[model samples]
Target: MKNPLILLALAATLSATAADAAEVPLYETGPAEDSSFVRFVNGGQQPLEIVATGSNARLTLDTAKPASDFLPIRAGKPIEGALVRGGAKRNVSVTVQPGEFASVVGLDDAAGGLRTVVVHEQPDDFNALKASVAFYNLDAQCASAALLAAGRNIVLLDQVPEGQSKRRQINPVPLSVQLSCAGQAVGQPLDLGTLEAGQRYTVFLVPAGKQSRIFQATDTVAR
Candidate 1:
């Protein structure tokens, strides 16, 4: 009873709409209202794909490279997404405030599982004459840890709780990072090379079987 011409036109319209939808990207540019940045870090062994949806949303992040531009998500709104690794996935979420710098770290659980930890990055107000350093605890096996600057006889951070981070501004120095648990050293101290002025850095304490080790990455924060 339906006219053949009418049916063909309807089919054509539907096809064109679907094609247009596909051309649109899943993550669009955030509005000017968004004033903060959230970076994603994949600390797990497998590569990860990160996504977030909310005000001033961010398109997906590929592999291990952090979002070149910090996610322009609205402050205080919940940004939720999933982390896909090797065909398997896990959910992750976080809320950030205006002018705040935050990150989501992908970590491995004790039972061979995977999870995410949301960390509020310490703000850096240092000028070109100084530098900043922050330490993150990702070693699930280690309950707590500390960072000592070798030969300086100084403790940069003490009693850093698991899944948390602490940061401080310091003069340019050659730092030997050490991790301790239950007041005992986890392993040999790690030479963090040299920290230069006007740069922001993060040290990640990661698990190595019964003990743990340290890895570092430079943040893209402008001084």
Candidate 2:
């Protein structure tokens, strides 16, 4: 009952809509990133739409308006007692194949409250991982830096250009590294309780009596 010209036009519109739907967005399979807003990181290969509520969130590649569509579950928000936004959840995700996994991070008002959380929904392989909240001061300047031990790895995260000190730091402490050496440490770790605005300390990762072991400082941030 439609005119020929109108029928052709309708077909083209439908085709374009379908193409847009097929082109997955960059949100999928990328580490969680937030310019100023907090969002969940999506880990699936296909881009997903995020649904967030007061205390619940989920990600799916289904692209359906509602949950009753054909979206596969890639990740999920924490329940009541997990390690994220105070065991809540964070916005950090990476693109993951069906059997692979990735993590996301959440930032707080204070650098001392930054936490990282890993999400796995019906994971194909490994389970989820979570690290306690590690605090950093943006106001302090980095002096010298070093690794904790022979086998431990340290992650010096990006700086917080917009913090109280106008400079912030995020770093990781590997548990595998022993916390001390012959009464001296490679550093004095960030001790939040005793620190002022521009003070700095180091944490020493003493070797476990292993000699001739070389230490590798991969991602260390020094000011």
**Compared with the true structure, what per-residue lDDT tens digits does model 1 show for residues 21-42?**
1222111231134465566676
Mind giving the per-residue lDDT tens digits that candidate 2 earns over 145-191?
22233243443322322121111222333333322223234333433
Candidate 1 residue spans exceeding 4 A from truth: 1-34, 51-69, 122-124, 151-153, 221-223
Candidate 2 weakest lDDT stretch, 10 residues:
2-11
Compared to the true structure, candidate 1 yields what TM-score?
0.68
- Give the lDDT of residue 38 in candidate 2: 18
lDDT of 1 at 40: 69
Q: CA lDDT of each candidate?
A: 0.59, 0.24
Model 2 ranges off by over 4 Å:
1-95, 109-146, 150-223
In order, what is each prediction's RMSD in angstroms? 11.9, 19.4
Which candidate leads in TM-score? Answer: 1
